[model samples]
Target: MTAETDLIKLYSQRILALAADMPLAERLEAPMASVKKRAPLCGSTVTVDLDVEDGRISRFGQDVKACALGQASAALMGQNILGRTQAEVEAARDALKAMLKDGGPPPGAPFAGYDVLEPARDYKNRHASIMLALEATSQAMAEAQQADCA
Candidate 1:
């Protein structure tokens, strides 16, 4: 098989496992902030709700409706977001975008698992789907912070 085929296989297998075992897959009953994002390129959507305490994520929940890649991305975010701050999530989001669009380095630890989707860099059509989770999480965090200040 060609290199592209190999990459595709790896991406598929990893995504399948992540999606099947997605963490924090349920929606919260009363989140401090809730936000939904859609990736127009793939019609992938992810809705995230979270509670913050002392500027850190205290709880998180999400409703995901997307392709395997989107699901995997959300799963990773769910797994590591329990103690993250808005700035951290935004940094990871920006780093992930740069990695996919400009060949920047993958995100650092905590969010480093995103590197698994590196093969997606070659498939521009998948970028939006991959970004859904990060975007939604960022929005939710920001909103929750604002609410706290109010």
Candidate 2:
């Protein structure tokens, strides 16, 4: 395939549209937990704010500063974040990492949409940025869990 095709494949219209429509694009005023992650290779940063209750996400928000790929990943996470448990978030994170780093398949429902990011596997440098939302969410969940137990 041509270089143009590669670019087009990586930056498809669906990905771009998801990036444009960032759900939960605001920070929560009193988040139960918050975390920020940065992709050094691309200087992409994402900060997530969340509230958890009864072992599930009750509220969520994010501040995304990255390319279309990162934004799209965040969009997918935001779309599926509500009511998710720590186990679900961690499962998605692990599955996404395995998919990108070890050629594994995407996670099941609630996170299967991340299959769109399959193209990102070919670009190692973009992996960190693409995984930012998941990383931040996982960290935030941990923090919330700790506070809940405290």
Clashing pairs in 1: none
Model 2 C-alpha lDDT versus the unseen true structure = 0.93
lDDT of 1 by residue, 33-137 (tens): 999999887799999989999999999999999888888888888889899988899999999999999998988978878788887888788899889999999
Q: Name the runs in model 2 displaced over 4 angstroms.
A: none
Each model's C-alpha lDDT? 0.89, 0.93
lDDT of 2 by residue, 53-147 (tens): 99999999999999999999999989889999999999999999999999999878987688888988988999999999999999999999899
Model 2 worst lDDT window (10 residues): 106-115
Error of 2 at 54 (Å): 0.7
Best by TM-score: 2
Q: Local error of candidate 2 at 31, Å?
A: 0.8
